[model samples]
Target chain A: MSADLLIELIGVGKSFPKVSRASDRLRALTSLLLGRSPGRVSNVLEGIDLTIHRGQSVGLIGENGAGKSTLLKVITGVYSASTGSVRRLGTIAPLLELGAGFHPEQSGRENLRTNALLLGMSPAELAASEADIIAFADIGDYIDEPVKHYSSGMVVRLGFAVIAALKPDLLITDEVLAVGDESFQKKCVRWMERYLADGGTLVLVSHSMYHIQKLCQHAIWLDRGRIRKQGDVFDVTQDYLAWHEKKSADTGIEHRLTANGEYAVLRFALNGDTGTLPIELPLGEDLLVDVELRGRDDRAPVFGIGFKRVDGTAVYGTGSEFERQPAKRLAHGHFAWRLRFPKPSLLPGTYVITAHALDPEGVRLFDDLPRTVIVRGRTPELGLVRLAHVWEDPT
Target chain B: MNLLISLLAHFVQREIRERFLGTVSGGAWLLIGPLLTLAAYLFVFAEVMKVRLHADAGDSFVVFLALGLWPWFAFSESILRGTTAIRQNAALIGKIALDRQLLVQAAVLSAFLIHGLGFVLVLIVLKLSGYALNLAGLPWVLLGLAGLALTAYGLALALAAAAVFLRDIESVLAQVLMLGMLLTPIFFPPSQIPARFAWFVSFNPLAVWIGCIRGGLLERGLPDASGLVLAGGVAIAALLIGRFVFRRAAPHFEDYL
Candidate 1:
């Protein structure tokens, strides 16, 4: 309610009924009459609190099904909160679902009027701004053609142009930049930079970390419908990245050997052969992954090592198969295995190291270590994956 | 009052644009269905059956037909279209801040406009074939439009509010409109009905409104000034009832939509 804050949300939450293709309308009605809550549906957002001030840009990041879109809808008044309040000091433009107001049968010229009217512009204002809208869209003769004939890219072009021209007080963008080609995406980014320079406020939701780090001063990370962490963009983003890396390293991981299925993995460490930490690795330094596994059965054991990028992209993965290493036969006791990489060639950002143990023939035995380790970048534009290449000139 | 008039103008323009987006045949296409039905009925009664029941009691059969048919068509279409207007534009209701009742008003106004044009064409035909327009009949057109606006507001609000929660109410309204067309005195004067059924025609409000129009154009003057007052009362009552229901139902629109 303060004068400086343009948007304020206090304890806002929302839930949607889960619907499947098999569930028909009649069943939905019958369930409604019975006054029993449906089993499958779950909450999409919960207990969200945030305040956005004038000229501040905030980024929203989350895993899939983490309620990013739902939060944007609540912020823009598309969906009223089930509980709590959302207060705004100025007009809001939810560019949430782009071209949602477009009618296919109408021409682009005519649809501009419809779009402008919905955006609170009167007919006379629309008429006055029509030329500017057309020029910005850059779709010369296509503006007079029916929108149904338009390609999807053309529609986004026109829709984005109209909204950008409006210069609303608060702009809410929800993955709209994911449309169109690479050049259009760059154009949108440039326009956003200009908008920020002009002191306009923005709430952007996207999965691109580079864009998030580039544009946002603050960020909120949502997990299963609640704010998991929020603060300066880099600090929260780094924490979130670290947490996600650790999580991906843990699931479906294998470990080995005890009387019961309760072997605890202890003393997970990655270093060079000389016991140097991963961060101190030289150009061709020996990289060693060391893990200690203890469990019920210890007769046949296999250990595997995999490395992946921050975005969950696998750069390279190697196990006993690729290394030509056989299972370490052992009695019921604690044991350790060391996997070595001749030269760690990962270029940048964040990388994860996961160790799993399986039976001699490759059935999962136990989880050992799922730790994330960062790879220092030697230079910009080196990219995340580094491959050795030899350059030669013809004599 | 000014706000309401401006709202009406906004919706009227929207309706015109949405309904007739392509080529403008002066919206004559909307009359095709009713004219076809009229021709089919004339064929059955005049050419096939050679039936002439109580034709001598009144004026020409077709003029009597025009008086009853046109106004009834307006009301029937208004109710039918108005019932589904909100549901058909769920996006607008779900996303925009425009008045929800405007959707219903647009439906009614568009139907009224089309019917008014049809009425003008029918009058032209009547005059060419030896019928006459009373010079003093201009006031009735104005009165009819006023009554239509009031009555249309009520029907639109009532049906739109109900349709939000009860999904089947739209079809129910359509069927009731069909039944209403038969109950109202559209093709014949109320005097032709028996005394016991007199209340059915008199109490049925559209019967009086249509009777006024028929009296003005065909009878060449006002038809029972008291009847106009009664019609106005009913229209006002419907408007009040519809507005009350609409306000009560407004809060639940977003939840259901």
Candidate 2:
């Protein structure tokens, strides 16, 4: 292995022995003693091939029970792989869970010493950083109390403080950021940013796409104990979110409607594509909606467009009638309108575009057509649309 | 190697502290408990039964029993605690990845360290009481105790690993150790047993260990070279078998635990 290669896994897999009954345990023990695989086993991960180089920040995104935690354990050597090989180099600090190595009966101070030593710090090294760790934790007087007496927030504070002081070559954290209060979470995020800037490697697992996009340069999506996709952070996370949107849309109520009555939509197209499939557009790109409606009695119908998130949250809506512009007359009973959003300021996610056709008065709804639009890009901003803003210098 | 040694030291310290954490008198009970047991044994055998040994003319029954009792406590207690070491720390084992053998070794080492200090205090008391002990044979007695400790550690390692798979080992071992103590001739000399059963004393490895220590302290002269050789062989064999079983079972402990 090269010195710069922090972790490497080739076709690695892990399985646990299934020993629900007393006889199964006996059989498993006997087989293990005799140098054989257990009689019955359940595989948690399969054919996982991953390589993480030094100074590389990677994010692991997956739903629950997708074997993300098991993969992390295998990388950290907590669980030996049942097949293939795993090789890791350098000092690794894994915050696998809350209070994992802590003794409930021991004081926080004592647990810190044990945990620091277990992370491969020498006695002298631990002594030097002891004060810095306590200060970072900032839990006065509670440090002397038993860990069982601490609140859950206090426990995570102490845990993160120890890891921060250690400054390991590689840091692996699993969903630990959600437990701390707002200030501490900010402190941890700032520390991690500095750590990464200083050439420290990181492998983070989180459900929040904002955090993943902010911290990681690469991402891997695991689905059903296998790597579904792995590549650039933007590409993989976008694909994962699109997959979730499609899944929920399948079980959601149908919105497609057949044309009926007067003022019905005769044809609709987004970006010149009239097909039923959703359209993918990059952020800050222009969106054009074209619709042709049928009007009775030769009166032009009003065309309106509405934008919403995949979860039915309205983002923006406007109609030609609101702007005092009438639809263009075409042939005998046909009317058409073209709506353009110049450089739409929408965040990266799936959104639905609904077109409405009304009578000339724009009071009664006549027809509705819905189409899906996926905005693709990577940004740490929250919410649906990016509001215009400017930050003035304090000086 | 340095890491392993440091980890072992930390675990041994924790094990000793855990033993007396909740007690009021704390460490004082270490010496006081053994002294009280000695007092009760003296009352029962020396006063009530009037037991005497034919092998030693000058030493009382209390002196003869004291020589063997403390070593037996160290040996038996080490096995008992070591057997439960893995099961007791299941929480730590399931979370952090470290050397599992250290847990068992720490338990055994702490037991011997505690009882060894008590054994030294007993020897000091015997010397101050005007007993004609062959103090020059102290090195041989120490060697005998070291051999017994090695044997106990070997058995502890094997039993501790097995106990992870078989919960019954802890309960069953208590009965077996009690029966073993009675069969080792700790209270009675080998000469008291019938001629037909004399072979039982000769075949018992613990009997050879107690005899070696008693010979050095009671002025029976240095232990015979053949008996020392026999004890050394058994200790080494037990250690090898214990290590073999422990290594095979260590990797699967997490699955079963």
Candidate 3:
């Protein structure tokens, strides 16, 4: 790690054991006695290596249960890793789990003292910053009222106001900005921007791609508690989204298992007559979809195929019934359902090809394939779904 | 020293505020506990059991018990509060960036301050009820507070550490306090006990400190020199042991909480 780096984590890993419902207390004790392990427990973070330079704003993006929050907490020392080391060069203000230190029964002023003290502010520091904290929280007479009486927004406002005033060397923020109203969210973002501009380091964990692109110069995508990709904000975010989209598509087909049973589309691909997978095509050329489906029963299924443009514009689809052809019987064996689209006029970008199978009674026998075809641009694109346009002007 | 004193000062003030705020009548009702306990003691011993001591030491036997009982109340409450001091504030201890040991000490200090104030009120009542104040025995009164403070401080740290791993310590300590009050020289002087069990009173730290206050404020003046010394020694030992436990438990606190 460079000397200028404000935070460094080397091979940092954390794991929590799965506590079975029947053996909760026993597992807790047994896990304690058995000691920590990499494989025996659920890894919330594994082999996390990152160096955050001073004044850098780093955004963390990942799917749900991707350990984004856990990584931030580890960086802030709210949680310690089971293995590896984290060396922090400056004071860290953990904005993770905001309003965590406030007492419910205590008045806002008293809670201010307690919270400030908890945050490592001295008595004098608290007293000096009291005016600014109160002004920012903006709960006039209610400052004397107990904190439990305050609304969720008021609590967040107070918490943010206190920390923003402190202006620590490093700020670790979780996805708590979503708690406040739109205006307050804007305020928080503005303050964060100012903090970064003033040479303060920030580690942010948010699910919002727009915020990550707008704020951070660098980003990390965590998947299954490990770094999947780390690079410039846009690149990592795009890759993460693409992977997320693929995962969702896989699950989308699986959800149809109630109707499809074990007979389902396993994979779908597109290729030319020579078996070359062309990403783009000449407007008059053919596009063939090779779909593989596995079946345990001889349902004598009739296949259906569709080629749709990226924007939900259906270019073409047909089944045996639609084509006025008799249905073919599918034996209890692996089979490929291939469909060709001739002179497909897909404009550019990506278009999806879906394949499914149905019985003669029109009931779905095997579900849809979980992949999309990319129809690249032969020329500079006008739109994703192309409609051949003819222009005639009379002057 | 300066930091310690300041931490203590703030803790004491906060404790006083919390106790008063927690009650319906605040400080006004603090007297109710001692007075009611005094009444019950007087009824049980003086009326129901018809027990009498040789010393005609006061206008009211109830006043004798109140003076001793109030201080012991402070000591016991301090120990009880100290037991959960760090555990109850697990959020503050685990998340906060302050000195971990100071948090436990603060709870001990708070309990001591409350009891100290209550101790003063009992003395004023004793003087008002015609018991003469021996100015010479004043050192022993201060010593009583010191003994209670040290013992409470030690127990606070130890219990704070133990409570992190074992939750049952809080309830166990409460039961210990109740049993301790009956065994100690709180309601009656240790001299009234039989010879064999007198050693039990001497062994119990609370008995030594509470007995010191009883002898100093009720008997005449100053506690026996050796007894006061033994009380101070036990208190010093408690403080040392408690400090060790607290420091050892500090690093694991974040994990457990």
Candidate 4:
């Protein structure tokens, strides 16, 4: 509870009952009556220990169902934690669900008065600031119209105008920038930048990595209701990208040998290792693909190797025909093909390398093996590949 | 306390204004509902059934009818609206965290104030009709109205909390309010009922508060001190219980919502 720290959560956890079926819900109610926990309690967040200080901006990045919204609700006092304690200092303006506080029956101008008062603004203070909020909102005649008649974008404009004007000590928002047009988003981003410059603390949750890296000083990567990794925005997002890259490549992927088939992929290796599939290779370094296959008849079976990004985005694909080389036979019904890149100028990301054994004609694929490889590099750049360039000085 | 009052005042103004928005007459529309009901009842009971207030008011049934009816309508309408105030403001509740009980109080107090206007007009009409109008009992009648409002607000707090958990309370309250209107001595005086049912009017808080209003303004000046004491006791007790239940149920509001 230091004066410098604005918010702190120690071992905070939240659980929601998983009641899909009516019987399950009924059981949950009965269990409550019986003074016992209901069936199938799923954790949305658990053992979460986080501290946010004044003037610090933190981003929460996670896939859907990763408990990002739930944690925000917990921090904002909307939902009580099921376990542990949370201590928050200073007033919090939680823009968790936009326009949730505005009365639909009231005019946009009238709603401003009520919502501002709810935020602890006095009548005299609200009167003084009303002109600024109305100008920022920029809905000229619609301010007199009831809120229910407002379009969605207009509502966001008004809500954002209120939040921007109040500028409370702690601002907690979820995907507010995702709404509205590009110019409005830009305006919000500029306001947020100024807000941070004025020593306001912010907790932002968004899916856009570009925005996260641009706005946040620190980030927490939440995966399956827990903090998987937390630190600098770029570092945590990189690790999170790699983890999902590996996971998606592994999900529902099975290695199967053809039943009673003549041709089979015996061993596929990346960088001289056959046991483990992943072999970390630096960007622009040589990647060696070694394949050992057993063919019933050796008429120079075709060998193919391809590289694809972890999310199944194809990077490069080539085979023996493309390389103008067929598989060289070593013994009866057994062949070994080796493809080496002296220096592969590929992108820095998670890539899946594939080894395929095809007929000599290469029209139909016979057998293939997939392996995930991490192409690690150090650069503050975006997109698939890094190209070498020189900056020209303009005189 | 002052902040709560200011907040509640703002909310009350919003509630009253928004209820009659886009109308030509503006705030005068707030009087329409209560006045219409009074006119309908005065025609039914006074002209048709030949009833009068205490048999001495002399053809001034409208004033006596209004004095008994308006405050009761205020209490009934306030309690009904207050029961659903929190649920109706779910948008505000879910977004901004504030003292949610203010929603209930604002709903109750606003309805009482607006309907109190119609009751004042009825008193003026009675004074013009040569009935003995004791201007000194004005504060006492206001106190009686305050007691009725407190009693209604306390009930509203409890009902709002219960309605959030069991939505059936809303419809159940509607049915009970229908019974309460018939059971209350609005159309007739308490002396008409049998002796066995004397406790029914004696124990009823609205009955005694209505009596104080009629006595202070129409018949007996200053009202019965015992009835005022009873009204105060009911207000305090209901308020304490209402606070107890509302505080206990406030945290669970998000769960059901």
Report i-RMS for every model: 5.4, 1.4, 4.5, 4.0
Candidate 2 vs 4: which has more TM-score? 2
Chain A TM-score for each of the predictions: 0.66, 0.90, 0.65, 0.80
lDDT of 1 by residue, A80-129 (tens): 67668999787677776666767687789877766666666656666788
Query: All candidates' lDDT scores?
Result: 0.70, 0.84, 0.70, 0.79
lDDT of 4 by residue, A109-185 (tens): 99887877777777787888999999988889999999999998888888888888887888998777778888888
Evaluation by DockQ, superior candidate among 1 and 4: 4
The candidate scoring highest on TM-score is 2
Q: Quote each prediction's TM-score.
A: 0.74, 0.90, 0.74, 0.85
Q: Which of 2 and 3 is the better model by TM-score? A: 2
- Scored against the true structure, residue A47 in model 2 reaches a CA lDDT of 94
Candidate 4 docking DockQ:
0.37
10 residues in a row with least lDDT, candidate 4 chain A: A252-261
What does candidate 2's lDDT look like per residue over A1-395, in tens digits? 37699999999888888888887867776776787887888988999999999998999998889999889888887677888899988888897685677888778988887888777887788889999999999999999888889999999899889999989888998678777899999998889889999999999999988778888999999998889999999889988987887777778885655556788988889988888889998988898888989988988888888898887778999988899887788888898888788889998889888888888888888888888899998777887899999999989
